[model samples]
Each structure stands twice: as C-alpha cells, then as structure tokens.
Target: MFVLDLIPAPTLRDVADILFLTFVTYQLYVWFRETRALRVLIGLLVLGAIYSLAKMWGFFLTTRVFQILWQVLLILLLILFQSEIRQVLEKVSPLRFLRTRKRSFHGAFVKSLIRTVFELADEKTGALIVLVRNDNPDEFIHSGHTIMALPESSLIKTIFSRHTPAHDGAIILSQDYITQMGCVLPLSEKKGIPEQYGTRHRAAVGISEKTDAVCIVVSEERSEVSTVTAGEIKTWEEPEHLAKQLKDWLGITESPSVKPKEYLKLAFVKNWGAKLGALAMVSVAWLILASQQEVKIDMIAQVKHVNIPAELILGPHSAKSVSLTLSGSRNSIKALKAQGVGVYVDLERLSSGTHQILLSAKNIDLPLGISVNNVRPKSIRINLEPLKKKVR
Candidate 1:
C-alpha cells in the first residue's frame, strides 16, 4: 500500500504514454526476434539496467562512467545495426500499414517452379532462385539482366543452362514473373554452415538472412534441393514434400492443418519469455526514467481570507501572497500551477487584535501527491481593524 501510494494516479496522458511505449517495444521485439541482433539488443538492455542500478545505489563513479559512455555507445550501435534499424523503421511506417492485396503463387507458377528445381537438381546444374516477399531484395541484387518474363520452366531452364553466361548467378522471382536473372547476391559468412554447401547455398542463406525472401538452392555436387528462410536451411528429399512446403510458404492453402486457435497460441506462446520481458522492461524503464524522480518547485499562491467577521477589515500588514516550496514527483511538480494552489487564513474565531497565524499544509489547497515543504513567512501577522461607519 505504501508503494502504491507513492505511485501517482495515472492520467489519460499517462495511459496513452504507456500504451504507445508498450507498442513500440513489442514491435521492436517482433522485428529483432529472428536475428542475432536481438541478442545484441538484450545486451544493451542489460547495460542499461546496470547503469540504472548504479545510479540508484549511489555508486557515483560507476554512474558517472556509464553516463559518459552512453553517448559513445549509442553512436557505435547506430553504426553496427544500421541495416536492422532501417528495416525496423520501414516496418513502422504509416504507409506500410495501408491495406494492400497479398500476392500468392498461382498453381501453374508453383508447378513450374517445382519442375524447374527438380530438372536442375537431376542434371547436377547448380542454380539459386530467390522468391520475393513483403521485403524486396532489390538493394541486394546486382548485375542482373531484367527478364520480366513469366515464370515458365522453359525460360528458367534456358537461363540456368550450363553453357549460358547468366547460369553462373541467381534468378529473382517476383509475383508471376521472373524479374531478374544472373544477379549476384551477398554471401553469408556465418560460421557453422556445412562445408558441403557451396557458393550457391551460401548466397541463398545470405539473401534469406538479409530480407524476408525465401531462397531455393539446387546443388550441382549433391543434386539435392535446399530451401533457406529467415536464415534457416531445410532440405527436401521428395519433390512432393518440397511442393507442399512451397505451397505453404506461398499461402496457396492446399489444406488447413493448423486451427486458428493454434495460430493464436503460436503468436502468444511461441516466444512468451521475450514478449513478457519486453513489456516489463518498458514498464520498469518508464517508472525509473519518467515517474520516480523527485523535484522541488517554488510557487507563489495568493493568501485567501475566509470566515472573517463582517465588521472587521484585514490590515495591510497581513500577507497577501505566500511562496510555497512544494516537493513531489516530477510530473506532479510539472502539472502544478500557482493559480490552482491557495493559502487560506481563517479569521472566524479571532478577535480584532493582531494574531500570528501559522501557515501549514492545512492552510494550503494543494493537489494530490504534493506537499508544502516550506512556506516563506511561516506565520503571518494579521491585524483586523473595526470598520468606521460610511458617511452618507
């Protein structure tokens, strides 16, 4: 209860602030969840927590060092995570939220894609094919010939034929079209990738890591088919299984194996720890950074006289204004105003003689969570004089 009392009652603005912060934090978690950058984010948060604890515990040297290092660390992080930062900003854009028709692979296109992959796999012809998703890989694709042709097996095979010049590079498949062929892709330098995987496989993993695109790699050495999505690689032994996987990835909806409840469960329960941690981190940070600070501000409020006898008039010697020293949370202090506060002096029972009236919290009308630490002129002398009869 004591802790609760210290917490100021939340206003509409406070609620909105929490809601917006919670949303941004959750979105950040969603964006970085699949990448190694998420671990880096967790590390940054750990550093922040340490800094906050150092400050709270009055470790002056530790706090001072962290304070000095924060600016440098911020710039370093911007340089290190520029790509992740750009992707996050793109996701949050207002225009990105505007509804648009979702693109899906047609049955014919899917069949052609599967046929092309198997044909290349059988002939031991190495090929890399990129399936574009919501995130365009145009920035990563270079030196590709613009084909803009339908995703027909004959055209794809012809482009990937061993003797063809473009067969050395990758082809990009967008909605219903082969947008580009012979495009060079960035290679993944990630450790622990199998030694058996060659340049084509590395390129597949590279593009998948950089964007939301699914990559298919047909190995010339093993004559096997492999798929990379979100930096994870999977191999399919049977063409039927690969076809099903492709259909699922393309949202073709051959059959609904999972229920809607399962999807809800996946959304909420998949990374439950990360989600809860994000919420808690934002809420705690808000308390530490926004609400818990103590501040003192001086306000001058008018001294109001109440219950004075009708025959008695206040003398000029009495104080007309009081300077109040108020202490409270930063928000409370910020919201306070001189006009909203009042110092009242009751003169109902007092006689006409000069009386020293002690000014205290009871004499002041103050908002909640605010206290008058000190008042200039703790006691004001009031002299009530009898009014003389008015001459007619």
Candidate 2:
C-alpha cells in the first residue's frame, strides 16, 4: 500500500478546493507581476523563510516575533497597498456589470480587432482600444458616443481614421460589440511617465490599473503598436505576435495547427525564467515549512513472542499489545505509521507459571528520528504450561 493510504482519501470537495486555490494563486501572480506589489510579496516570502528556519532551530524568541508579525501581516499589507488591492478585487469581482454577457463570435471579433490595429499602424493613424472584462468602464462611456454596434474591421478603421471626429478618443469594446466610441479615459496620475509617451499611453495605463481591461494603442508618431494591461505596457513590432498576444489576453483559442512539441518549445522559450523561479520558490518553501512542523501520534503495536523453547507451551498473556506514543516530525511519523513498528519479548530462558516482562523504549524497534515518549501497561504477565508427554 502507498503511504498516502495511511491517511484518509481526499473527497471531491478537496479536489475542487485545491483547483480553486491554484487558479486564484495564478491570477494573483499574474496581477502582481511587473507591479510594486511584487517586491512586497518577495519580502513576505523572505520573512516566512526566516520564521521557518527559526522554528526548526528552536529559537523561541525569534519564532514568537515572526508568529506575531504573521498574525497581522494581512492587515499590514492591506493598509500599505490599499489602492493596488482595490484594483485587483475590482477586476476579480463577479458583481461587475461588464462581465454579464452571452456567448458570441469571439474568434471573428479578435481577428477583426487585430486586423484593424495593424491597418491603423500601417496608415500612421493613432488608435486606443480598451477591451473591458470583469470591471465596468461605464463611467467613461458618458464622455463619448455609444455605438452598441457589432465589431468589424472596416468600421473600427473608419472610427479611428485621422480625419474622423472620434479619432482622438478611445473606443470601448465589450466582447464582440463596440460599447462606446470617442470615449475620453482617465489619465494616469502616476509619476515618472516617460516624455515620449503621449496622453494616450497614460490614459491606457490608467484604465488598466483601475480595471482588468486590456488596452491596445497605435502610436501616431512612430506607427508602433503597444499593449497595456495591469499597469504594464509592452511594445510589439510584428503584427502576428501582437495578434497572438491579443488572442491570449482575450482567452480566445486558435485552431490547433501547431504541433504539441512546437507549442511546448515556444511556451518554454517565452517565460522559462519565471516558471523555473516559481517552482524553486515553492519547493524551498515546502521544505522549510515541512521541517519545522512536529507531530505526536499514539499507536497500538502488537507484541511478538520470540525465541520460545519447543517444550514450552505459551498460555494466556495479560496483554498481547502495547499502546505507544511516539513523537517526531510529521514526515517521520507518517513513514513509521506506513511501515509499522512492533515490540518483542524474549521467552527462551523463562520457565515460569506467571512472570512479568518489563517493557521499555528499547523493547520496541522504531525508525530513525522517531522516539517513544509513553507506553501503556509497561509490563506484561505471561503464564506458561509444560507440554504433556505423549503415551505410546
């Protein structure tokens, strides 16, 4: 039997809980990446490492201080990055009206959007398109004209034309429909915005920082295409690459044309560093936490009668098993439970009607790192009877 069988099997609810937690963690990592909160998260992990080490080394004072800090760490983080937390919560909230929608032609919409963006880039016409997701960007909608029209490449290009009246503002897209056009967005008040970035870039970053919307901008001066999401902006030179990124951000899956190996290679080459770093961090954290956790378990071990003479017939014994309490690290205890431990009694030299055999820690064979702390019925009484001679 596997070691896991020593414990109760996980239910469907447990699987669901694990999957939910994994999804949330991935989302949080994506949101925190390229943001100031990344540094805070690293610092917290460092503190956790220190606490684990202190606990393993039995440093009471240091461990106590870290434990106290851990108790208030959540509140402290909330107070320190209240704005960033609010933004993330708003993006993940289900109550946002922008997320309530029926399924439509997502593939066609993504293709049209990509085609329109590249067309505007080639013509040197500037465009800012905001793709709203969970968060409602309705506050900025009143500042512009509401189109509520189907998404099409030609229509998008005409709306963003240099001579058009709506060319100066942004167009808001909800799924496959154009919700609004000529919408003036909130400009980012964040300091240190580069002088090269015009008002459009700042506005794109502003809306992205406040919501979960993906913003695409085509620069009029350089005809460069850029995407802004989660307060970070990345410039793309190739139209295909830009299109692929937009499809990914919008969760639009393309036809399965690429081979599995080629897709894996591309994924690895894209973000291997981040993926490896996350794996290493999780491994180290698990090690530290596991090493510091101690557990005590009470188990009943059978007593084995060994080295008994053939002439002796064993009679009833006061106790056939002993209760043992073992203490060690959780891993060690689990292994011991899986493998099982037992106590032995030597009756080769005993020829008694009633005799008590004293049991101690030495009587039981235990695995390394595990120690017996308590044993019930420290001694056992054995009653032996001699075998009768057989008549010929």
Candidate 3:
C-alpha cells in the first residue's frame, strides 16, 4: 500500500504514454539486434544503471567520474560505429518494407544450385557462390562482370570449372538470375579461422557477416560443401537439410507440418525472453524518469469574479491575474493547462463596499496530484460602487 501510494494513480494518458514508450524501446531493440553495435549499446546501458545507482546511494565520487566518462565514451562510440549507425538508420526506413524484390528462386533454381555445388565439390574445384537476400551486397562486392542469365546447373558448373577464366572468383545469384561472376569479395579478418579454410571460405564468411546474403563455399582440397550466414559456417552433408534451410531463408513455400495457430504460437515463443526484456527495460526507465520525480513550475492564473451582487455595478482591483506555484510529477506538471487554471472570487456574501478576498489553494482549480504551492497577491481589495437609480 505504501509503495502504491508513492506512485501517482494511472490515467488513460499515462497508459497510452507508457505503451508508446514500450513500443519504441522494443523496436530499437529489434534494430540493434541486427547490427554489431548491440554489444556497445548494452555496455552503455549497464554503465547508465551503475551511474543511477551511485547517485541514488550517495556515491558522489563514482557519480562524478561517470558524468565525465559519458562524454568521452560518446565520442569514441560515434567514431568506432559510424558505419553500424548508418546501417541501423537504413533499417529504420519504413519504405524498405514496402519495396519488394522480384524473386525468381523457385524449387527448380534451388535444385540447380544444389546440383552445381556438389558437382564442383566432387571435382575438388574451389568455388564461391553468393545468394543475395533482402540486403543489397553491391557495396561490399566489386569488379564483377554482369551476366543476368537464368540460373541453370550446366551454366553454373561451366562458370566454376577450373578451365574458365572466371572460375577463380565468385558468382552472385540474385533472385532467379545469375547477376554477376568473377566478383572480388572482401575476406574475413576475424581470428580463430580454421587452417583448412582457404580464401574462398573466408570470403564467404566476410560477405555473410556484412549483409544478409547466404554464401556457399566449395572446398577444392576436401570436396566439401559449406554454407556461411551471419559469420557462421556449417557443412551440409545431407541434401534434405540443406534444401530445407535454403527454402526457409529464401521465403519458399513448403508443405505445412503444423497448423496455422500453432505456427504463430511458435513464432511468438521463439524469442520470448528478448521481448520481455525490452518491455521491462522500458518500464524501469519510465518509472525512474517520469513517475517518481517531482518538479515545480510557475504559471499565471487569471482572476475571475463570480456571483457578484446585482446591486454592485462597478469594481476596481489590481488582482486581474495572480502568479501560481504548482508542484507535481514531471508528467503531471507537463500536462497542466495554464489557460484552464484561474482564481475564482466569491462576491455574493459581501455588500457594496471596499472588501478584501483571500486567495488560497481552495480558490484555484488544478488537476489531480498537482497542488498550488504559493500565490502572489494573496488577497484582492475591490471597490464596489452602488448602482444609481435612474428616473423613469
């Protein structure tokens, strides 16, 4: 009960405000998850929490250090994550979802891709193939001659053969078309790569890490087929599993194994923890910044004379307006309407004479949780002249 008392009662506006904040926080979480800057964001959040705790518990020294550290950290983060920040901004564009790609990767094209990959692997010929997804990989790839031919097993095999001049570089498959061949791709610089993985495998991992493209690398020495996505590599020994993964990634329809309702339920349950975490973080931030903190604001309230006697026709007073001091939670203070607030003076009880009326909290109208702290010109003196009777 005490804890509930500490928090102001929830209103419809409060509910809507918090819900909007939660939605924004969750969307930000989703965007950051796709970028390499997520870890940096988490580190900053952790430091913020520490700073808040230090200030709350009177750890002045630690609080001061963090205040200075934040400035330096911000500069460093901007310098280090410039590209990642740009990528995140690009992801936030609403038009991106509306722009759809013309996909030609059907069952037939997938089958051709499978055949071409294994055939090259069986011949111990090194090959690299990039399958473009939603993200355009043109910025990361260069020096490729455009082909734009239909994806066929024989054609793909011929291009990757040791005899062809283009066999040394990679081929890019976009939608249903072989967009380019002999394309130079960036190589992964990440340490801990296996000694067996050659330049082809490194290039596959590199491109996949930078974009959403799937890279398939065929090892010439081992005659193995491996797929790289999001900087991770997996060797596919079975054709069925590889086909299933490719279909899932490329948005190909498959025979349904579960009901529609069950599929939706599984999708919701897939990342339940992350979704809950985003909501909880938003709630805590709202509580600290808006719900608990109290702020004071000064505003002017116009004086309004009500229920004046009919016999009293004239009035002269300096109490045309009064300055009011109000205090409440930050949100409540922000929502106050200056025009709606006024000091009402009751004149029905007084006779036609010079009289003074006291102004207090009772005379002013205010919203819930907001209280009038002080009022200037605490009392108003008015001179009411008696109405003169005119001869008829």
- Give candidate 3 regions above 4 Å deviation: 1-4, 8-36, 50-75, 106-108, 143-168, 186-206, 219-223, 228-235, 240-260, 292-325, 330-392
For this target, which candidate reaches the highest lDDT against the unseen true structure? 1
The prediction achieving the highest TM-score against the true structure is 1
Alpha-carbon local distance difference test for all models: 0.82, 0.78, 0.80
The sequence of per-residue lDDT tens digits that candidate 3 reaches over residues 1-392 is 54554555557886788777776666666655644567778888899989988876679999999999999998998899776676666667787778885453665688768877888889898889999988889998879889889878788888888899989899998877889999999887655678999899999987886788888999999999999987788999877788888887777865557989999898568678876777688778767666546778888888888887888864665357889899987656655652368788887877887877788899987878898889887887766778889989
- TM-score winner, 1 or 2: 1
Supply the global lDDT for candidate 3.
0.80
* Number of clashes recorded per candidate: 0, 0, 0
Give the range of the ten consecutive residues with the poorest summed lDDT in model 3: 1-10
Which candidate would rank higher by TM-score, 1 or 3? 1
The reply for model 2, stretches above 4 Å from the true place, is 1-28, 79-127, 131-136, 139-169, 174-178, 181-195, 205-214, 223-258, 264-269, 295-325, 330-379, 382-392
- Please give the lDDT score for candidate 2: 0.78
lDDT of 2 by residue, 1-392 (tens): 66454443335764565455545555677677756787788788788778877877789999999888887998889898887788777767667656554333376767667777877888898999998876677764438897799878888888988779988999988877888999999886665667888989999998987876899999989888899997788998877887777776776755458999999898667666666565556545544455435678999998888877788777875468889999987767877887888898888998857888999998899877888899998788877778778999
When sorted by TM-score, best at the front, the candidate numbers are 1, 3, 2
TM-score of each: 0.66, 0.56, 0.63
